[model samples]
Target: MELRCKVFLRYCTCFAVIGALLVWPAPVHSAVVVIGARPYLERVAKRVVEILEGRYISGNSLPIADYVAPIQLTDKGLSITGNVSFHSAFLAKIDSIEFDAQKFSEIFLNTEVTVQGALKWHGIGVVLDFAANLEEYNGTGTLYVTYNQFDFPLKVTKPFNSTEPTGSLQFMSIDNSNKIVTVGYPNNKYVQLISRAIMTNFDFRDYMIASFRNWNFQNLLKAVIDEVPFPEVCYNC
Candidate 1:
């Protein structure tokens, strides 16, 4: 009887352990590390550039708000005050784009873009509180701007309660010289003066950076990459 009771107790303990093993939830494998991620990132960058170029060509160009700046300067006892306004501005075309993948989460982009718009400048010569309209210039033209080697850093975040990861592309660290803006206008003293004044007062680089910062390229990239079956390794399992 004693032997039978001991055998029965051991069987019950085994059944309890088996039941616990069967009922407990399995560990969730939530982390994955991408292998050879550079090529994939390069592809994603190309696709994003293509999409942006296509969109710009298809009449979905980015619209710029009307910009107005007040210009004031004094040289050789000559006071000049003016107001410059740029209107109907649009980032009309993307001529070319080049991508360099520096790392799995960082990319550098070089692009040439064209901005078409109209500008008006009204200047007054102020002498001893007496102001008179000296020059009023109005013109329409295109600005060819080149951005060289601008950094796009990828940021990934996972919510505390969510398993899916979210990503974003951030624009960062563009050299002022790299943001080159050139326009062709008739070579005249008045035009030259206006151009110099406008260029001095208006920051084209900041405007371009602001426009790019507003765009979310990660969504476009994810749309293409999600369909691809890239090799990955398990992480934090």
Candidate 2:
């Protein structure tokens, strides 16, 4: 009886400890909004820019950077915020040909992304993938976004038809060439460029661009951080 009682007492103690851990509230939701540029999102955007440019973008931070949101922890779901947009998504490609045009690229996407998982709390980044079309050139690549120091690798390819050597589509007027080549395209010419390049039933570049514009992880995270009910990590689980 004595031995049985001891074993029972130990079992009860273990259960009590387990109960404390289970009932413990998930630390708390912490979010912050930064007016200045954020490093993680910047890295993601920079990678996107590099992919667009056909070469790695120079500098650690984009010349123009906007911060949106931070990661959010909530009972309902994990929500993140922020958006980073560039004036031009152009790559410099020169040919010894008749026209002297600076290669500029832009992306548009319609993205609805919501994910739920246990975060390491340190840092991790995940880059989404999307199809791409730069003027007449079409391809697929990844958008590398990160969180808490982890890098997310996303590569989306665009399978384009074997188009003629020459094709024309309107481009964003981030540079002078786009202004000159505006015809048969809407004033907001993301449509024209994407339409001509993909040459398929579905448009991946535009879709991805829309997704990146609204929730490029960094911006979403920034927004979440900003909207978080607390600053110093109330429940930093």
Candidate 2 achieves a global lDDT of: 0.29
Candidate lDDT scores, in order, read: 0.46, 0.29
RMSD (Cα, Å) for all candidates, in order, is 12.5, 23.6
Question: lDDT per residue, candidate 1, 77-137, as tens digits?
Answer: 6545565455555554444555644344422123211111111111111001111233444
Which 10-residue window in model 1 sums to the lowest lDDT? Answer: 121-130
- What lDDT score is found at residue 1 in candidate 2? 100
What's the TM-score of each model vs. the native? 0.54, 0.16
- Give candidate 2 misplaced runs (Cα > 4 Å): 28-31, 35-237
lDDT of 2 by residue, 105-191 (tens): 222233211111111112212233334323333343433322221112222111122111111111121112112221222223333
Candidate 1 off by > 4 Å? 1-33, 73-80, 103-150, 155-165, 184-187, 197-199, 202-208, 229-231
